[model samples]
Target chain A: MVKLLRSDFRRLWRSKLFYLGITAVAASVAFGLINNVHYKRIMLNLEIPIDNILFLGTLVIGFAIAIFTSFFVGTEYSDGTMRSKVVVGHNRSMIYLSHFLTTTFAAVFMMVIGTAVIVVVGIPWMGSFVTSCTILLPQILCCLLSIVALNAMILLLAMLIPSKAICAIVCLVLVMVMTNMISPTLWSKLEADPIIPEMSYTDSEGVVHTQPEQPNPHYATGTTRTILQLCYDMLPTAQMYQYGYDKIPKNIHLFPLYSVLFIGVLSTVGACAFRRRDLK
Target chain B: MEYVLTTSALSKKYRNFEALKDMTMHIPKGSIYGFVGRNGAGKTTLIRVICGLQEPTSGEYTLYGISNKDRRIAKSRHRMGAVVETPSIYLDMTAEDNLKQQALVLGLPSYERIPEILKLVGLENTGKKKARHFSLGMKQRLGIAVALIGNPDFIVLDEPINGLDPQGIVEVRELILKLNHEHGITVLISSHILGELSKLATHYGFIEKGHVVKEISAAELEAVCRRCIKVEVSDTKALIRVLDRMKKDYEVISDTQANIYGVVVLSELVLALAEEKCDLLASHEQDENLETYFINLVGGGENG
Candidate 1:
């Protein structure tokens, strides 16, 4: 397994996709920070806090990790380089584990690149974090765990699907679905105002009318809110979306635990399925 | 004689289709074992099973005396390398890089033999060109080079010459011979080309419909192969008539070619053909062809 990891890392280092991923992470961070800061400074004449955009890199890193993991690992299947490994006596589980760990490390390493860009490009434009380290550090840690979880999920798709093109398409589509559709929908449901605000209107005849406050039908309350919040926290994509929006969950302690479970369960399932697969 | 690989009643079924059933064969150490079969005859299936790419549905096999069930079978497999159906190489990498990657996988102590392996495969001059740009022949050679990096004693090549041009075929053939004769590498080559395999194989395993039909050493096969006189005549019909009157068994290959079975009296045959107003263009005494030998063993078919 050590040799396998070493070889995989060597390929990762040499892979153009790896460097390209780092560039994409930096570009995404730059894009998000520049777009936000430029918009606020020019139009609103307000300097945003570093806190608002500190997690910007993490948001882009999630997408970068998806594309990188798919192609990096998918190359083995596409090129048939995997056959020689099994032929030379490398256990199938070891192969799976090596890829899982290698891609995880790659995601973390790209996170570092993203963080550097945020500090270099973002801190100058927006002031330093107004939130104290005590509060800020855990949020960053959750972001890392979330990215790792996302990478592991992508690795599962890569392992099960052998065609590089198809695996890449699947990974890209899955991330897009999670980031764009599922996470935002959950947030919308959970963050609905509990009661509608009172409104006043004057008719054309000059008579004033008032509408009393009422319970907002769309608001998720009690158990429904709890389940929806838990689902949002459990999903890596939702975690990244929350980070991007700078919204802390009600139960902030649970995101890391959920990420770990996602990593463990997804990898275990993937390895078992890969073991039973009849490889070409 | 010792065998490097031996399979006993191996079976593999994909859904309801049995690719291999009760297939048994032995590949002796230090011999080029030719695995012959038609398409869909389970040749690749058997190779895949032995290479650990796929598991057998039943029965067992041993490599270097270690059973497949034994954990030590991995150690045994470390001494072998295989190219199944196509060359297993990273097309995006250069030949040198491909070898280096394989060396990393094998965990070789050093890269000293890499240059030698490259020269052996005739890719030494191709410094930075990736495998994607290589000709079919070079890619095939590079695949063999990757296999050789581990310095394994046994190598399995599945249809190595499948799509090579004449020049590529000769180069690959000579390389296979050099590997076996000079390096003493045990080779298990599976191909449908009997004429090509006959030139290199010291032993053979004939398979048909998921089972081995026969296993014979080259020497043994040569001794059992029929003897006949091949003749290219101006009129095969006249020659056939003369042969029938003489009570001899013969087969017509074409309008002007035929093989007379058994030892023939050339002088008597010529006089008989002369009386029939037929001229023999050419005549040669040789052992029955490998294709004929295979057809005789497995019954005539397109592959044979």
Candidate 2:
């Protein structure tokens, strides 16, 4: 296992993908920081909270992580580089694990560094409104784990998909759509409040009555918050982020545990399928 | 002597296409085994299966007396190296870095062996120059260097000289010979280049349409491909009479021609034929080259 990891690390370090990803992450963070300052200056009322600003920056960083993971693994698969490893008598399981760990670690490291740069740049602009180091530290750690989820999800798709271009495009789309769809559900579950309908109401009518003054609960309440929330709550990513947000009970730490277990299972299944697949 | 690598009824099917069909081969220890075939004749498929890149649909193979079904087959395979189809090196890494990666994969204790392996493949001074900048020959040498990292006793090379210049081909040929002669590494080389293979191979297996049609040693093949004096005689019956008196080994190719597989004194044979009332229209010494022998063995077709 160590041997396999070392090989993958060397390959990843030598490839242009690593440098390109780091540059991309740095540029995106710089852009986000500059854009936040400009937007704040343009509209004095648009007071962006430092926590939300950093959160949004890390969210963009998550997408970058997803792209990096896909390309890193996808390039090898596309070019038939894995053939040598397979031919060299290495265990296929070890190969998958090595790539998975290396890519995931890289994603986390890039995001952390990118986030640090953003925070440093934001200190003068945001003044005292900047996020506290204490809160920001854990958020950064949780943000890294969240980005790992994105990495796992994207890596799984790249392994299963045949075409690199198609795999990468589809992975980004799936992650953007699914993460958007899954986050609010997690927020709703952790906060114990619905994401839509504007207001929760109780009527004091004489007989049993329902308030229909809200923005249609049937559609608005469940679209992003109800059904998908249940689904997201069942996922490890949702659980990990929810626990890290300090919204759930301490006992709910099991979510990250479940997340780890679930990701492990999915990655194993992906690796097995990849192993059985015929290289073109 | 026990065989170093043997396949018994080994077969691999990719969905509906049967890539290999009961390919049973025996490569004796220390022998330079030549796996000869045209493209899609299951050469690469067999190599992939033996290297564990793909599983066989049916049948088994043994490495150094260890059966594929046995748990110890992996341990047995640890002593093997292979370069399948193309050079499998990271193009962005230098040749030395690529070797290091391979060494890492094989779990070598240190990077100490990297220098020696690089020297062996004649790539010692390619320090920090990435493989993408390498010439095709350099890339190929690096691939061989990567394969030799663990000092395996058995090596499989698939068309190692397929895309080389004359000089590159000579370099690879000499390297292969050195490996076998000095290092005692048994090699399985598969190629459609029968000429180059004929020079290096000690044993030959001719595969056609996923089947081993014939397997022969170098000596047997040489005997089968005997050099002969080809003669086109005006009167073939007279030519046979002349040959019968001399008691030489020959084959009657046609009614008007024959090939005599023996030393012939031109004047004596002409005199003998004249006495037998045979008119030798044309005569020439013919040595069977690999192309002719391959065509004779596997049926003739325009080289495609």
Number of the top DockQ candidate: 1
- Could you give candidate 2's fraction of true interface contacts? 0.48
**Model 1 clashing residue pairs (backbone):** none
| DockQ of each model vs. true complex | 0.64, 0.44
Worst 10 residues of 2 chain A by lDDT: A244-253
True contacts kept of each: 0.75, 0.48
What is the TM-score (0 to 1) of candidate 2? 0.82
DockQ of the two-chain complex in candidate 1: 0.64
- Restricted to chain B, the TM-score per model reads 0.82, 0.85
lDDT of 1 at A214: 92
Docking class of 1: medium
Tens-digit lDDT track of model 1 for B192-247: 98889999999999999999999999998875676978899999889989999998
Tell me the lDDT of candidate 1.
0.89
Show how many residue pairs clash in every candidate, following the order shown. Answer: 0, 1
